[model samples]
Target: MPCLPHELIAWKILVRLPTKSLLQLRCVCKAWRDIISGADPSFSQAHLDHLHQQVKKPYSLLIAPRIKSESDMEDPRDTRRPWADMKVTSPGLYLWEESQKDIATLLFDISSFPAEGAATRHGLTHCDGLVFLPAEDTVRVLNPATRQIRVLPWSLNSVAPRRCPQGEGHQAFGFGRDHRSNAYKVARFFHRETRGMGGLGMEVFTIGKDQCWRETAVQPPYPFVAGLTATFFKGSLIWTIDYYSPMYDYSHLDDAANMPCFVRFNLEDESFSVMTGPPWYKGPTILTPTLPR
Candidate 1:
């Protein structure tokens, strides 16, 4: 059989396949693997672009469930009980595809990624086929398609959750690719309190490149409420402003004060900007209008 040109194989035929299939095809030979696994930046971007264009659902929904061990004696979430101290045993990541709307396919198990103590919260973030799993101190970058896991360096700024549930400090995370540098980056907002001193700051870490978390010159305009995942869109990470309180205090506020506002951090320039929230009618509605006078 006449051998196909590299362009025809890589660009035309290979780019058409989904990421999972492409990863598996890597074992076919070293040459094909290089093309599929991002040896060529253009090919990598082209494949991602192809996936976005062809699949209505460009990204997979990664579900990281906090499964409590059977031996857990108390519920950490119980307000009445003392800090349960029950460890969060996440059962690894599950992938939900558009084709399988009703079922979520398990990709990797907990044993695949090991960690000490509680490793994850309830949320997961995805961008360009990569899943970002943020833990207490370390952030893991997982390619569900390839089942490749890259654990990043522990951040000194990350404040470990306290024995009491409320002691969990304020922190939010986002992950995305910087088009200019062609590198994946993780951004975070944190307010660490110790010795009666609290400080708000932002940090960025470029995967496979940065040895440590670099504090960004741009700080978050508003404090981001913890437990809320930042959305990565168009080369930026955006988070809703926690106007009411920085310590996850959601109570004692009227409806008008509860409306959400956003702050955006650009990956390329490492700049922060405010984004307006959706238009909401703030005027009170008259229960019954006088019949047109």
Candidate 2:
């Protein structure tokens, strides 16, 4: 294998390459391929740990315009969409540094995204540098820096049990890394009509490998509020629901609303568990996970 310039030989420099370029580099030679692939679990972990010890700083923000179907631009298919300002459309993906500096650089067009007939109204979820853009009927996983994309299988909600009259449920999405296998995963949840309004449907997609969605077990105790965002933290996806809402029929059980709980789905194990929420939490409230100092 030919030697790379001393500067380019470093793993740190190579890891910074955009997704496409890094992949292209793999074709350069056997040596380059090994270096790129080696950075996966072992090298990547050490590098990130070193960075955490340094002074903390604000990172870039993932910005996309509000979910507006008519306003989504699928035509001009440019990465940066330099002429985007001309059309009264929406804001494309860009990075914002401290003091609101615009980096109109990365081209992350999910249209023709993970599927053919482009999905619309992207709901973005970010974790460990992978951004999940959930569209109408499809879900796209992307590394904006790497320029890599993964599209998930279509939702089987249409054919799943209790298709008609969806039984007053909400859709939630969680994206995070499964430390056990060192792979990224996406977890989606929603409610299906069943006895006692306790049945919840869950489907999981492992990025880059799984081609289809696999259903899992869920017996929810609260009524899910539709359109509420799901958060990913510590390998678990958490969703907030209304425990006392009229939407939940409580005749068969005790006061369902009296105990508000968090429906947590662990990505690696692919299991659902319920835990007692904060004592202050009485009704539905927005919840997100964060690292402690």
The lDDT values for all models are 0.69, 0.58
In model 2, which runs have C-alpha deviations exceeding 4 angstroms?
A: 1-30, 37-53, 67-91, 99-122, 159-170, 193-198, 217-223, 244-247, 250-258, 284-293
lDDT of 2 by residue, 150-254 (tens): 677777653332242343233556678887887788776665544346555677777767777777664444555444446777777776665444447545545
What lDDT tens digits, residue by residue, belong to model 1 across residues 148-249? 788888788776676322365457788888989878999888875732113568899998789999999766666765656677778887776665453344
Q: Any residue pairs clashing in model 1, and if so which?
A: none
Q: What value of lDDT does candidate 1 attain over all alpha carbons?
A: 0.69
For every model in order, what is the number of clashing pairs?
A: 0, 3
Regions of model 1 farther than 4 Å from truth: 55-60, 73-84, 111-122, 162-166, 194-198, 244-260, 281-293
lDDT of 2: 0.58
